[model samples]
Target: MAMRKLKHKQVPVWIRLRHLPVELWTVKGLSTVASGIGRPLYPDAITRACTRLDFAHVCVMLDVSSKLPKHIIIMMPKEEGGEITCKIDVEYEWLPPKCTSCMTLGHMAKVCAFTKPSNPAIPPVSVLFLKRYLQGHHPCSRLKGWTNRERDELPHGKTKREYRRLKGWTTSERDESISCRPKRRTTKERDESVLVKEG
Candidate 1:
């Protein structure tokens, strides 16, 4: 037999119904409440046994395109004649990421292949490149701004003696052979300088 791949957009997710009325604890009531969200499958063992009163767990088949509501209003028949309204909160246990670009499941719309990036001017960074950059394994030359340590470690065509001599010299001199950028001062240093100027 030839194997065939099946793509299903509708998925069964376990949802919790909170603040349910006492009259709606039965199978029919649970089904009626869950129907508002999706196709109700069945309640959990605990829900059926009524062991836990916190919430009722039910498996609901939800479509990827369907709107996931946070709360649903239910109309309960009063003892006299008119029906009373009650609000029940719906909590999904787990839901797969859906892509709105292609109307498919598994991936989000932001990272979808069919969807174009909002800004084409800036290129997206790869996971491996970001990981290596974070780990300090990648070269800092490609980056726009460089830290003091990175600047110090950068290759300059100067001799060891000349490099050591230039290291101690803090003069603000910019030469073609040597790149001399002023060191960034901390907030405390800036505050001290401000006080000295004020005095």
Candidate 2:
């Protein structure tokens, strides 16, 4: 049997709250603190029983696009009518892969279909391949000198024939452009050329 792929943007996640004050162990207090991360669902069995003083486990309905903060600051009212600040640490048991481009769950931003270039002239390259190529790892590193803006105008992951056809460049023009680039000279050859120039 085939099952349909479900796109889950919002999910219930179990988060551990650390450094929680003794007074905030109640249901009301736990909900208030958990609300900082997401809509508070309910606390775990241990949390409800107050059997564990180390941390409180609460299930929250979290949105994939919500910012995951390491720590959250909470203000508590003191007996003297002033407020005291408390810092709570948050820990997620697990998180699903999220796509920042589409702001959805189950996929990462790099492989996001929405981020793929719409123009057929620019063949789509994997984010990892494009990153490495830009860093001079690819054999076609000659194109490394081109800025991102310029590279956006060029066809990537295409053969020379395809590139020529896409850019409407003739063989002579392509050869001329290739020849215009400065050739790499060895250290010894460069020194000899310098000595000859000085002579």
Candidate 3:
């Protein structure tokens, strides 16, 4: 027996396309060129004929529906073909949010009843290490392979000094100001300076 494949139904999303050329406002003009950017919503997608829902007073609103999340459609006018360049805005402000917890649409994680109970929050040990590291409290020995001058030159805070003392690492009287460190000249600057001298 040949198994028939199940076709998944596409959800129609409402989107507003803005800044379309005034000429392309008609169903025929929009339908002809719209597919090049994104699939039109339906009910005369190809002909792009405005459905009862898409029509406005004195204007025919083209159906701009797609199964895709987002699109940046480019269109060519019938008269000009590929000569003129233009951009159209496709807004999906009415699209519902897909919930992560429940694997359903229209709600967020905060309101989803399917969300798992979270464990009690505990303070992380890495936070202390990171705070110390950012405060110029890293071990001097970690500066290995760097110049002895740079190693001796790096600064640590008073709190860092206390921590370093506790760790039995050498504490120095030298400046521990991380931001005040002199900027090293790069090769580009050196080359530019040499070129300026030659010029």
Candidate 4:
């Protein structure tokens, strides 16, 4: 065990936190960051090594540099993981962009083989609206408010007229269509109808 400890101590590993907030250059903030980094890296879980914070940067020491993580999580005192928390967003030092489609890293889902290719026929905005918007289809604003006079002047009058007609479907028409549809018979109604027929 003594020999192993000596061998491990021979190699030194270090990491730097670049562009650290100027406000967090104080002793307390630096110590906290250092402690947080040290806890997971050390087998002993010693959190006392974050003593160095120099010029918007923090230098941390670790036992093994090869196993360094891509990113480090630091909790700020101002907010405790709330929506309004003042977060310190840091890019990973080594990890690539994650592909949510196949749940992998190093590439995005756009070129993922497991995912089906997006339909070329559909507009991107339409696809986004379909995913995000819960309400029924809404015509684009330019297609809306197209007056009959404007439609006559435009070369695509037939298409405009059809679109306007479709959009002009009234609440009365919706109600009429709904009333015209057959209603499902409830269990009680079915039983009552059977009894009446027997009577």
Model 2 per-residue lDDT tens digits across residues 105-160:
88899888778767649587698767755554333344456322232232455322
Q: Which stretches of candidate 3 lie over 4 Å from their true place?
A: 1-10, 32-39, 42-71, 75-82, 100-103, 113-115, 118-199
* Deviation (Å) of 21 in candidate 3: 1.5
Instruction: Mark the regions of model 2 whose C-alpha exceeds 4 Å error after superposition.
Output: 1-7, 117-199
Write down the RMSD of all candidates, one decimal each.
Answer: 15.4, 17.7, 19.7, 21.3
Error of 2 at 141 (Å): 31
- Show where candidate 4 strays beyond 4 Å: 1-5, 9-14, 39-55, 77-199
The C-alpha stretches of model 1 lying farther than 4 A from their native spots are 1-7, 116-199
What digit string (tens of lDDT, one per residue) describes model 1 on residues 6-38? 556899999999999988999999999999999
Global local distance difference test of model 4: 0.41
lDDT, candidates in the order shown: 0.74, 0.75, 0.45, 0.41
The number of clashing residue pairs in model 1 is 0
lDDT per residue (tens digit) for residues 72-154 in model 3: 45545456465566666555535456555555566677876557456747776787667556435444534443322232333
Backbone clashes in model 2, listed as residue pairs = none
Q: Please write out the lDDT profile of model 4 over residues 115-181, one tens digit for every residue.
A: 8656657645676566323222342322344332343323323322322222233224444331223
